[model samples]
Target: MKPRSTGTANGCEWTSGTSPLLTIRGLCKSYGTNRVLDGVSLTVRPGRIVGLIGENGAGKSTLVKCILGLVPHDGGTIDRRATVAAIHQELSLAGGLSVTANLFLGRERRTRLGTLDHRTMQREAAAIFARLGVEIDPRAEVESLSVAQMQWVAIARALSAEARLLILDEPTALLNRDESTKLFTVLRALRGRGHAMLFISHKLDEVAALCDELIVLRDGVVVSSGTERLEPEEMARRMVGRELEALYPPRAVPQAGTVLRLEGAFGGSFELHVGEILGVAGLAGQGQADLGETLAGFRPLRSGGLTVQGRPVRFRSPRMARAAGIGYLAADRLRDGIWRDFTVAEHVGLGDLPRYTRRGHVQHAAIRSATERFIDTFQIRCRGPAALVGELSGGNQQKVSMAKVLGAEPQVVVFNEPTQGVDVGARQEIYSFIARLAARGVAVLLVSSDMQELIGLCRRVLVMRAGRIAGCVEEDPITEESLIYLATGVHGT
Candidate 1:
């Protein structure tokens, strides 16, 4: 079987070998009462890239885990003849380690004298980065590199071994368009080398561009697959079982009231009105993090004041910000958003403990009840309110984080990379939820590097460039080209 030509992937062609490289049949998995994977089947042939996509709770991650033997499946047959490597979605490389050390941390090459061959490792690391078209100092600490650079290192690590199969989970979620294009070029090169890969991402366009074959799961079952090709929108519709009436809900008109104003802000001094999604758009490290953190009280302003309803307020901490009706959702849902060891009920209850407490004693019943409501409202997939928050998928964790913020009943909500690692189907729902929040008169401050997101969701966007405001884009004038131009300051004064 051969895939139809796709321009997004630079017209790469692949042929399925006479025999399959990997075959999965009748896979089954269950967690107590919830059946995550049921009767799922697929074949991954050599010299081809396969795309796997679905909603957050759609069992995409579960399938990957089962195939990788990372988890035990209930009933399944996985036949594999090729060595496999998986690139994680999180920080798989240690920050304290150097790039050279990280790439060969476990599988270090050694001389016959039983000594670690540091020289060979360094030379090989450089060669790998060169092949991937990325520049990284072998001795440079992993902590110092940018996200794109780290991703390149991860890719190098995966290819470092002579594995024929590579699995990438959300490879470009944090990267910008230019970075994504470079990554795609590397992927095309890998395909040219007759490497088999599985590309899993929430970005449907990316899947369409890179995959020679596609599989989409929904509610623990495969709903669509193609030896031919499927459009991103069509795949999206099948995944969610509904037409995308609007990928982004309609934006509401902002009132004549400025709910929150940042005076002399670090990234960009901007005013957010009630019922508006004020976007902060820029490339990574252009002070967008500063803007979001400074607003959320995670960082202190050097020479700025935040005014709420004309009253100047100084928040020294996140508690102070929340007390002043400012709710924040950090980009990293695991690190800053929720407690991994905590239960779903505990995570949500921490948002507004007062509502779940009577007297000084904690109300366990109230907490459980509130968590149940939240789980149902957000459609979070878990065993129950007592399930560990970290055990849930990335999308569910994100929903829990959003639920915590909404429970705070804040007048101002700040979301950093609102849908960073979320799948396409879940992304639409989250977008609608955020839109509804804005419609309900919540002043939302959205800071992200995704130009499409900023253009699709924000009515007005403030483009940041090198810690300063480059331009303010209104609804009519906001485009990917315009946002990138303004963000990079490549076209106007």
Candidate 2:
């Protein structure tokens, strides 16, 4: 192949052909009898991003896991000797460690005396965040950050490694619009510097805008591959087809009842009608959590009280909230929804084991049956009920969390960023479940940072600003524009 010049960056030209930074041919992975990947082939050249697009459980995450050496692909020729690194959807950073520490934990800079060079790591960490167009404190602990903020730390850690072949799997799943934009800017800059990247995301728009080439995968095989970047809509159509696979399950038939009611509360008062998907939306830390936490009993309600099914109640803790027939699906699934070492079956029976108990003993049979039911109902992909929750992909993990929540059969469900790290397909499953719950007269409170999520899935939206409800947008005027104006106070209500 000829060494043709595309464009020169920093005095070096990125050319195509014989020397791909990473190449995979006839890759295959199967779990027991089910094949997850089959004969997948692709090449990622330096200074280019090869987007891997697919619906949830369509082998995208499995493919990256195979590349990262985290999972064993059954068969394939992966001719790669480069320093390969990946930042997966589920973050594995140390919560107690500082950003600089997490960034350079295994490969810390040391002086001749062999002591860690803290100042150097801090400076470099700060520089990496700045380059990514995000402002995060290098000294801040990972546990003290939001989901979006934590995602930046993960990106910083991957970039700081300076790997030759970097793989990012849904890195923006938790990020807001601004954070995602910043991340894209940094990815483009890295591409200019001759870095090779495999970008896996459900956000096809990002794939369309950032990737130099795209590969669409479906049902364990390659469906389409394009050398040139494709438009967002076209890429989306290729991935899932023109007609959506019932993105949001048809709204459950409406019912007249009151599931949760808050009086004179922070972020203003709002009553959750039974079967209503009430959206509490705003930018990060703009009181979305203030309302969600209060309702979930993670934060104390100071002024007014809560009423469940027309009965006045006050919750002292999350335990109390759960006892009151409330299901709280936190925004950060890893931190709040999961026990890292627990199994799928164990997580399924987490909050309410009594239901599975028989004759003063925990009935393993009952738990097994329930696990099977939840797996089938939630469409969770796993190696059976014994599979460790941590071993599942982020999307699968989100499904597990959903199963855990809905398994309790609560009268009301509160989801704070319900689809944060989930893929487009899994998102539909989750949305369908929420709607189904509402159709059954179970109220839902959806607190999301994604404007589109709120507009599309919610019937009533209350925008919060500075810890108060700025305004309300009902079904009639519930466009993204109105939500933005209400959240930012940019336009007259």
Candidate 3:
């Protein structure tokens, strides 16, 4: 094939293809009777970023595993000519160690006497960070750096091993808008330098913006593959095998009855009405997350109090909050929402075990039946209720988390970044689910950093800044400009 020349992103020259870095032909993988990947074929060439798009349980993760050699493929051949590395959604860097130490954890430089060579490691780490256009300090603790910086560190570690083909899985799931932009800039720079990348993301707009080519997977097969720039809607359609009409469902008019009210907390007072989708919006670390945590009883209110339907209450723990008809969907699903090792039945039953317990014994059959109901209701894709939560995709795991939350039958639900790492199809499903909750007279406090989510679905939005409610935007047509002004206090130029 002839090489295609693309304009330079930074200072490096960009050419399309030259001796494919990794090639897979007729790849097949399965888990017992269920086929995960079937006859999937793709090629990653240097100087190009390829987007691997798919819905939950569509075999994207399995293809990645097969490439990384984490799992043996059942059939087909993978002809790889270069070193490969992966950057997963969850970072693998040790928090207790310094950036340099974490980068060279397993492969450390050895001195003539065989002592730990901290100085040489720090020097090499600094060099890699500089090459990546990042300014992270090598001697700094990994935990002390920002999420975006840590991602850069992960990329640098991969590159330090002389890896030619890089696999990134949901790298921006934890980053804010600005942080994500910076990450994209660095990635483009890498592309300019002829580094092959397989970028897996649920955010289609991001894939549209960054990828030079698109490979859409559906139902364990490659449905579409091309270099043409496709719209997000078209990509979503190809991924799900249907046209997605709208991302956010129709908004419901909230009732006048107040379901939850907070007094002297979050530097102000706010009331959530029945069937209302009240949005809590702000920049990162600006007290919005704290507001969600406090409402869900993860933390104590310093001097204020909470009232559920006019009944004054102070919750000391999450269990206390649940007992008071409050449910919280944590932002970090893997860490707080769902347990990886636990089954779907166990997840739904752990929080509401009393409903299944009888005669001083936990009823396993009752829990399984209830879990199956949730599986159908949420459209969670899995073998059955006995499937481990870890084995499911990010979107399915999120569905299970939502099922666990709604199982408690709470009057007030606090959804923290409800679609953080979910795909477009699953995101729409979650939006409809939230709307249904509101239609059922359940109040929802949506704490999210996604501006479109705030504008698209919220009836009223409260913007927080510097540990206080900066302003409230209830006007019709709440735009991103208004939210940014309220969030950063930068009005007229």
Q: Which candidate should be chosen as best, given TM-score against the real structure?
A: 3
**Which regions of candidate 3 fall more than 4 Å away from where they truly are?**
1-17
Better of 1 and 3 by TM-score: 3
lDDT by residue (227-253, candidate 3, tens digit) is 988999899999999878788988868
How much is 385 displaced in model 3, in angstroms?
A: 2.0
Off by over 4 Å in 2: 1-18, 95-98, 117-156, 228-243, 250-254, 340-343, 382-388, 475-477
Clashes of 1: 0
Ranking by TM-score: 3, 1, 2
Instruction: Report the C-alpha lDDT of model 2 over 1-493, residue by residue, as the tens digit.
Output: 0122234553223344436877789999998888889999998888888899887667887887777777888898776645567877678899999988999988899988999999989999989987777899999998998877788787778778656678888888767687778778878887787778898888777777788889998888988997866876566666665455656665554478777888877746778887888888887678887788878778888887789888898888987888888889888888888887999999887758878887888877778889999889888888899999887767789888888887888888889888876667677778888888888888888999887777777878889988888878986647888888877778754
* Model 1 / residue 472 / CA error / Å: 0.9
Q: Which pairs clash inside model 1?
A: none
TM-scores of all models? 0.92, 0.86, 0.95
Clashing pairs in 3: none
Total clashing residue pairs per candidate?
0, 0, 0
Pairs of colliding residues, candidate 2: none
